[model samples]
Target: MPDTTLSNCVRDAATQAAGLPRRRSVPVSLIAAVAALGGLLFGYDTGIISAALLFIGDTFALDDTVKQIVTAAIVAGALVGCLAAGP
Candidate 1:
């Protein structure tokens, strides 16, 4: 339960709703364009990672510990990205 109520969201007189965000949505074309770009980037990244990991694993002859290190590094990078974008 929230102890403090959020009041930053204000409804205009035109709408009867209060204490809630107004219903809003981005345009479908804009949303679809962003989604398409994100999907493309995701596919490209996964493909690159698959190829890179083969060389990376062989170069390190990675033990479980080293594999963990690589995984942790990627996780840390994602966390930093989230922190940068968060409110």
Candidate 2:
């Protein structure tokens, strides 16, 4: 077998020769801003759904149970997506 030390030295030298830059960290303020915007959009979405429920109910003849389900569905889907995408 080849010497481990020599192999590691060559591998490291090859890596350095590739000249790839290290990954940079994101700024806290930018992260916070994006989170805030997401929250705002979510709030607006629920608010619009609530506001339109009356018209939707009239059009679709949805009962109380179904309306409750419709309202909860968005939240449930968001929960599932977040869990699936989590580390």
Candidate 3:
């Protein structure tokens, strides 16, 4: 069997010699705040259209078919955008 304790000691010594910081410099709170802001913006962007569509439909005097088409167009645009940003 391999000498696990010896291997661990060597690994720790190598890491210490490399002069890398063992602790994180950036705060976790800052990372969480940024992530939360992104989520809020994404939620607002996807949800605002539904609320605005009511006023838009009334102002334009749009029928159900046209209103559906407008909503579908927004969804299709989002789908295309997501596809374009694929991993």
Candidate 4:
């Protein structure tokens, strides 16, 4: 019963999405591209620590807890970057 209702909702949403006119799609495309680029930047920033973490720890001679703290700081910076950029 729930599955049927869910399927109907999905079908309705798909129909609505498909029925929309795309004549003024350039703005939409630009928005999507910007959003995707933001994601890429976020991914790049997040992944950078993977390459530099050992160097960061070794350079700083950090312990396990400190290493976790350093790694978490990168994620925190990403969050701050996103917040600064805003939605």
- Tell me, by TM-score, which candidate is best: 4
In model 1, state the lDDT of residue 82: 69
Q: Once model 4 is optimally superposed onto the true structure by TM-score, how far is the C-alpha of residue 62 displaced, in angstroms?
A: 1.0
Tell me the tens digit of each residue's lDDT in model 2 across 1-87: 955798677776776789854333579778988999989988998899898899989999999999999999988988898899897
> Residue by residue across 3-71, what tens digits does model 3's lDDT show?
579867787677799986445447787888888997897678768888888899999999889988988
TM-scores of all candidate predictions against the true structure: 0.47, 0.62, 0.47, 0.63
Select the stronger candidate by lDDT from 2 and 3.
2
**What are the per-residue Cα lDDT tens digits for candidate 1 across 1-87?**
533434422334335554545566679778898989977975686567667777888897877677667766765876798699897
Q: What lDDT score belongs to each candidate, Candidate 1 first? A: 0.68, 0.85, 0.81, 0.80
Whose TM-score is higher: candidate 3's or candidate 4's?
Answer: 4
lDDT of 4 by residue, 1-87 (tens): 454688677776777889953244789899999989988987897688777887978888878898788788888987797799886
Q: Local error of candidate 2 at 67, Å?
A: 0.6
Q: After TM-score superposition, what is the CA distance of residue 3 in candidate 2 from its true location, in Å?
A: 62
lDDT, model 4: 0.80
Instruction: Please report the TM-score between candidate 1 and the true structure.
Output: 0.47
What lDDT is reached at residue 83 by model 1?
A: 93
> In lDDT terms, how accurate is model 1?
0.68
Model 4 superposed RMSD (Cα): 6.8
Best by lDDT: 2
